[model samples]
Target: MLIEQSPSLPTVAVVGLGKIGLTLAAVFANNGYRVFGADINKGVVKTINQGKSHIRNEPGLDHLILTAQTNKTLSATTSTSEAVARADIIVVIVPVLVDDQNNIDYQFIDGAVQNIANGLKKGSLVIFETTLPPGDTKNRFGRRIEEISGLRLGRDFHLAYSPERVYSNRILQDLKNYPKVVGGLDKRSLELASNFYKQAIGCELIEVSSLETAEFSKVAECVYRDVNIALANELAQFAEKKDVNMSEVIVASNSQPYSHLHSPGIGVGGHCIPIYPYFFINKGLNQGLTPLSRKINDNMAEYAISKIERGIESFVDKNILILGLSYRENVKEPTKSTALLLIEQLRNKKANLFVNDPQFTESEITKYGVKPISLNDKAVSTIDVVILQAFHQEYSKIDFSQFSNCKFVLDGRNKLNKDEISQLGIKYEGIGL
Candidate 1:
């Protein structure tokens, strides 16, 4: 029940060593804070403690890990108790996913809260940085933690919600650029947690009145992107019917200087945009919330998959290559990614699927009971169709000579230049153009 004040920096424990958690740990460690990261995965713990990286995203993860190791200021463990008991501040970043039925799943977050309750000490601050349904962190996690630990809020312990606004590929850059939003159960809770993030991120820390406001802000940001993307998706479909290039149309519209249009793609992927719209739609149903945004984004996936299928109708047994598997380019996370949905839909049609991603290895793909072909393999000849799912840099630099044997190309990302592809003598089609 005692809190220790270290001379160097406050000791912090970051629970759930996923993409966000590990990145935050390294950032904090780089800033001279003593950090202990805990994860259920033993391999992740070993990699961090041994000064190696488990995931690839940030450029200086290895350098940060080495710094943490040399200073003996950062370590990781498989034991959640050891992590919680040793720290004065705890940050939680876990996934809260949605099912096909539009139900929110909180098994991961709930289990993490239970662990925090078991080991949380008096005078320690606990911040929930994961995006969740509005008021769930304040009413659900706060109440449960208090009951189990017998610690009163604002007296013995503190709890707050600080939703992370980090982009997938630009985590390090956004850490300094994006403002941190925090809301808490009480005033003291807000100050304690906001100060911690302000120090590590070195950005503006915005405080809202309550925890639900912070949660709503996070969901609202993603929903805004979803709605705008859906507008582009809908416009793309109409533009195709009119025989107009959607990309050129959007570019022309932007000349007005008042119009900002998002690009259309195979579909909206990633954990945020695809999932957050439902949280708002379902929760605000009685308030007359019509989720036109969620409907459009969800349908775009099926539409793109259907285009791929229709493009190869002449081929009996098809060999299809998906260019990228990760949600977006330059990131390793594939959580709730649209590529899996597209892959599953293609499998149901009994088509031969060949997957290729530079980020993932053959062993990782084998874990899913499916092996993807290497993009570098010259033997991968005579592909019936190729879907450019992710616009990775490697895919951009690919020589047209290698894909000469391919019959058609479906540009889901609209990554290729329209005029240049027509000169290549291959049939190329994109989402809008």
Candidate 2:
């Protein structure tokens, strides 16, 4: 049941006002709780205080922000400590990233902990919503909170871990719909967290035994996807050699109640899938599937570029325009996007590379060391190859004839209409098809 606004509802302090963080704040504010969002970005804070959303292309976010602001139940702040001091519950969604060597970097989480600890009071519940390696939630954060705040774990303050399970464009809906898995440092922390989310989220809550379980469950879920995608990628390559359509095969195989196979793509990129496997693999476990899958998925970028290379004679000065800049379809986030890896390979080959995405500005695309080219621009006539890295809806009805000199279209994602491209006198090839 949606609770009505009441003064008794605990105030929520949401640290990190990124897209997911901000959306969560708005939802909590609407759900009968006072919400204060904290971010280091002053501009984002100012935009929220003015009752406007700085995030674009997300459905209904602007109106939600407006409603929250109008009610004066939500506010923004530049200090995490400032926000934490006024709240009974503090939710930290600060990101924990992996570096190039696949080593976990806790800088952002460490900084957030420092600030949160400074203002953390006794008897408040602290829940971390970021996905971490198995025991880092307790070892990296829980102990640090105790040291800094001078509070006892179960008696003075509460600590728990709950992974964020929402997607980029569907955060609000997923939060209400998805099963929320939560674990705590102890039974006291678990009970308090379960009670808080039971009302704040109003979603079905699954309580586990320990913080490590909640943390591992999230990474395990992501690792499962990475492993399956690697299998699909390998199968896609074999299908390409055997002249079989992997997509059709997958459709047929998935018809069974027991078989579930993921799609094959040029690369797997996102905050979750590509990075989380390392959180498990780096535990120094001697696992075969996990490490091999990581290798296969990471190599997919080079494999895709190799396919394009075999199609053309030389990439020394060829005009190759990449169709999408984002790693995924329709979302503006480019974190660890496969398109970046492809660009690096093509750059080494010295191809004249260009990119276009409907979600990003020209300046944004150019920052990646590639010129931005639009399908409508007259310069499209000079391109030789078109690779569909991301299957954004805007590219569905693309006019192939516009690329007058284009010789091949490589559907890195199996999203393009091959029959239409071939009928238009262009050589069309999709992965595993």
Candidate 3:
């Protein structure tokens, strides 16, 4: 039974109030839809209901969320049933984590679908924005929703897949600007999902053939980045052995047509790139290449540690300071951070470690088993080595001369001025230069 399009604005329920989910909720609300956001966390629900954002450092998002709340177009609740009961469209954006044994955990997504099933009305369209293994959307997710709701997938309710394709900080802009890839269980399902997104997001839609294609597309994008970054990291290692500046080579090589070389850093971080490879591995496909790319990128952290050891002759007993704890610049998220991996390895050597990041508080830093200090703290002068793991904007203002006792500085992101650091009489080592 295909539900006729509502004459009034459709109510949208967005599950999981994480970064991506919250942003999508805001997008729908801003576009004049009555939006209900559902999260299991009571604190998140309370915060959103107060017309404030739980997500940090997103430009224009706070004002957009406040506007949505003021206009009575958006609200949040801890109970998923309450949000989904009257929603004409439901969007699931819960996370799918990869375990240590390289297994994809569907616990979060499964729980969210079960909650939706409890209140799922016939003729409502359900769309998933979370990344899943190729066939998991139709096989696992669609089947589970049907079993829990006692509704046929396409006949009683429409099911679709449209993976979220936005970066962390610029989610709002990317959501409106990027082309959305949408697929569904049937033609009617695809039309409903695509038309809703077309009007709600005001973005171009790329309709694919099936749900499996949509699922694989998102994973493929992340895997491509992971492989490209691994190539850059491998080249950097070769340049390190030959005493050549790999950044210079990269700049020169990228000038040629059809060349798109990624930058080499300590390691690839963030929730998507590092974890998406596991989805492919879980299916027992791409056994050799994907896993090897992951291994190469993973080892870059150890490679950075080896560089720090070489830079400081007496590394074991030295006092070291790490400048950034977040996975990337300007974002507070530490999911799959290479800096965390580096800190873990450094702690095993029994070195006195201090960390500073403008994005995190002192309490957050303590969780990593390191002393928290400000960038301009007086203790920085006594450190033997400074590792620049992330290049936060505030870090650009720091005076490297303050580290008078520092013998070496490892630039993991190529952030420091090599010539300036050399003039300060400190040994400088960068990832590729």
Candidate 4:
């Protein structure tokens, strides 16, 4: 049963007002708990306090924030002490970034735990929603909290690891509807964390035996997708050499009940799939396959460039327009975007590159050192090649006939209709088909 709001509902302090953190804050506030959001960025804090969303393209986030603000259930602050002092539950939702060398950087989570430790109170429950490698939550985070706060685990306070499983665009619905996996240091801690989530978020609470198991489950979810995507990419490459339509093959193959293959793209992007395989490899487990998948996905941009190279005789003086700069469709986040890597490779070859994404501002597109053009601009008609990178919703409505003089349309994603574009006298090629 969903827990109804009472005067006794525990206050929630969510640190780090990033995509996940801000959404979670809104979730708790809408559920009738007082939520205090803490972030290092003053602008983000200000935006949340003003009942506006700093994150873009998230459906219904702004309205949720406004409702929370209007009801006096949500507020934000930069001071970690102020955010957690009056709260009975402190939730750490900071990011765990992967460095250039593929090593897990714990700086963000470390700083968050230290701040939470500073305001640690007796009888309060501390739950970590950040993704971590196996043993990180127990050995590193829990140890640090105990050291800094001088609190005994499961005695003075409780600790748990519950990874956030929601995607960027579907956070609110997922948080309320999805099953929440939680694990703790001991039985008492587990019970406390599980009961709180059951009443708080009103989602089905799944309990694991150890904190490490909970952490590993989250990493494994991403690794599974990454490995499957790598398989699809490998098959796509082989199909290209044989002049086979891989997308058609995939469609036929998926008709079998046991067959479930992911679609091939120019490259894997976003925060999770590109980053999570490293957590397994770094821990000295699944040494070969994990690293190999990461390498394959990472080099997919080069594979895409190879396709462009094969289609065109030369890159010199070629007018190439890349459609969609953001990592994915509709979402504005570009973290570890493969399009950025493709742009860098194209620039090295002295190709004239132009980008267009409805979600990105002109200045944002220019930061990539490429000219920003509209989808309907006259320059698009004169382009020699059009690379459809991301499948943004706006691109679906584009009139392909407008590109009157374009010679090639390299669909980085399988978004364009091959027969239709071919009939229009434009050479159409996609990643798999």
* Per-candidate local distance difference test: 0.80, 0.88, 0.88, 0.86
Return the candidate ranking by TM-score, descending: 2, 3, 4, 1
| Best-first order by lDDT | 2, 3, 4, 1
**C-alpha lDDT of residue 204 in model 4:** 88
> Compared with the true structure, what per-residue lDDT tens digits does model 4 show for residues 26-71?
8888886888889989999888888889987678888989998888
Candidate 2 per-residue C-alpha lDDT over 90-135 given as tens digits, one digit per residue, 9 for 90 to 100: 9999888889888888898899999999999889999999889998
Which residue pairs show backbone clashes in model 1?
none
Record all residue pairs in model 3 with backbone atoms less than 3 Å apart, i.e. clashing: none
Which 10 residues in a row give candidate 1 its minimum summed lDDT?
1-10
Tens-digit lDDT track for model 3 on 337-407? 88888888888887888999989999999999889998668888899988888899998877988889988
Supply the global lDDT for candidate 4. 0.86
lDDT winner between candidates 1 and 4: 4
Q: Worst 10-residue stretch by lDDT in candidate 4?
A: 1-10
| lDDT of residue 33 for candidate 3 | 87
RMSD of each: 2.8, 2.7, 2.9, 3.1
Task: List where candidate 1 sits over 4 angstroms from the true fold.
Answer: 1-8, 286-290, 308-311, 367-371
- Report the error of model 3 at residue 276, Å: 0.5
Q: Where does candidate 3 have its weakest 10-residue lDDT segment?
A: 1-10
Assess candidate 1 and give its lDDT. 0.80
